[model samples]
Target: MKKPKTTNRYCKFCKKRTSQKLAAVKTGTPSSLKRGSKYRMRKRGLNRGFGNKGKTSRGALGSWKRYGVKGSKKISLKYTCGDCKKVGLSANTIRSKKLQFE
Candidate 1:
């Protein structure tokens, strides 16, 4: 099999590429957690009696209805040079726009 493309790119926070490690993409939940206990599983409905109504449940609304809640999964990537952490969205957006990296 062909090897995956891995790059030793510089991290502004680290101020160097030598310390950068290959980060694997996290795809999904582990198999061991897939079969959650029956006692832990809660019923899905408008009135399941948790806190507020189930109307606020993440799965209840469509993407358009959810708006800001949708597409909000962000990965934290830290840099040592600036001693700061950057989120995935900002990093991806900057890269896509071809903006000059500092």
Candidate 2:
């Protein structure tokens, strides 16, 4: 696999990107882990429920849409400041500053 490109940019929260590093991300565990062993052994929907196809239901297109959700949920990796080690600023802020300097 190819590596992602990095540019000479300032991390406002960190104040600079000189010492930043890529942080490892982890995957979420299955919901079944929360149940007891006995419960896990019993097949789900064995009695009252229909088979997987008809039993499972989902909303139509745009049915689950919500408004005013914050941007933090959409971003995974954040730029950690090399100077102060803080991590919450918009990426556009960095880009605008770079353009101004150039």
Candidate 1 minimal-lDDT segment of 10 residues: 93-102
Best by lDDT: 2
Q: What is the TM-score of each candidate against the true structure?
A: 0.25, 0.29
For model 1, the superposed segments whose C-alpha errors exceed 4 Å read 1-6, 24-60, 63-90, 93-102
- Predictions in order: lDDT: 0.35, 0.37
Tens digit per residue, CA lDDT, model 1, 1-102: 122233345665556554332232334543342233221233233246555343334443433355365343443333322223431122541112121222
Q: Over 4 Å off in model 2, which ranges?
A: 4-8, 14-17, 24-48, 54-77, 88-102
Query: For residues 7-77, what per-residue lDDT tens digits would candidate 2 score against the true structure?
Result: 34476654544554333223354446334332332345355465433322332212333323333333233
Deviation in Å, model 1, residue 18 alpha carbon: 1.8
